[model samples]
Target: MSSSPEKFSKNAVIVNELGLHARSAAKIAEIARTAKSKIWVIRDGEKADAASIIDMLALACSKGTRVTISADYSEDIEILNRIKALIQNGFGE
Candidate 1:
């Protein structure tokens, strides 16, 4: 068994028209819950749990905002990548 968990981190821009609002935050949280990793999003030096809609909304991210995401898990990297793509694609708007 591994002694330490694998980690993933990346920066993504909020390109959606509405930014990181309640609905968008819900979408992010929905996807985040599928992974075993603990995911966190950082904006302007403030960090929020990606699995929590309220935490995400508290970041107050607007369109064109840049955010950093970090995940720690023992599973494949697909989860983190998927989240990155979702943010990059503006969560399909």
Candidate 2:
């Protein structure tokens, strides 16, 4: 499906001690790939494609960083929630 400007977002903090590192970014990207709608992680007014490891890493999100996880469509809200849960869980680190 095409991405829309409209989206649902939830704020979350990076709980992993090591932060959003390569391994954790990979997990987030993997989840993003499964979503039918576009997904993104926004931090400090910067947004990154959730499916791109490089983009996620670019956020420079360290532990305790606050970010907003959003999906382009309401139907994809669950996807964002999953992402939030992953971040809250420290990407299972």
Candidate 3:
């Protein structure tokens, strides 16, 4: 893989009232695991593996929580976008 910074990062807020609990975290983790890239989520400057549902849920992302996502590799863009959309759309209820 080209280590030429072929990555994209974004800071976003969690808008879901229920926060990133098990089901929501599962959804995100499932998608992240299928991606051909390394994904991470940062909260309060602490980062965790995005592909791990347990790790994500441990973050306890409540409503209005800010998170920084960083993905290393080209295919990460679409995945990141979907993640952002999920957060924005309230995890589709």
Q: Top TM-score: which candidate number?
A: 2
Model 1 lDDT, residue 28, Cα: 79
TM-score of each: 0.85, 0.90, 0.87
Q: Which prediction has the highest lDDT against the true structure?
A: 2
Ranking by TM-score: 2, 3, 1
lDDT of each: 0.81, 0.88, 0.82
lDDT of residue 23 for candidate 3: 86
| Minimal lDDT window, size 10, model 1 | 1-10
What are the runs in model 3 whose C-alpha is more than 4 Å off?
1-7
* Per-residue accuracy of model 2 over 1-93 as CA lDDT, tens digit each: 455444488899999999988999899899999998778899988999999999989999999999988887888788888889999988887
Candidate 3 colliding pairs = none
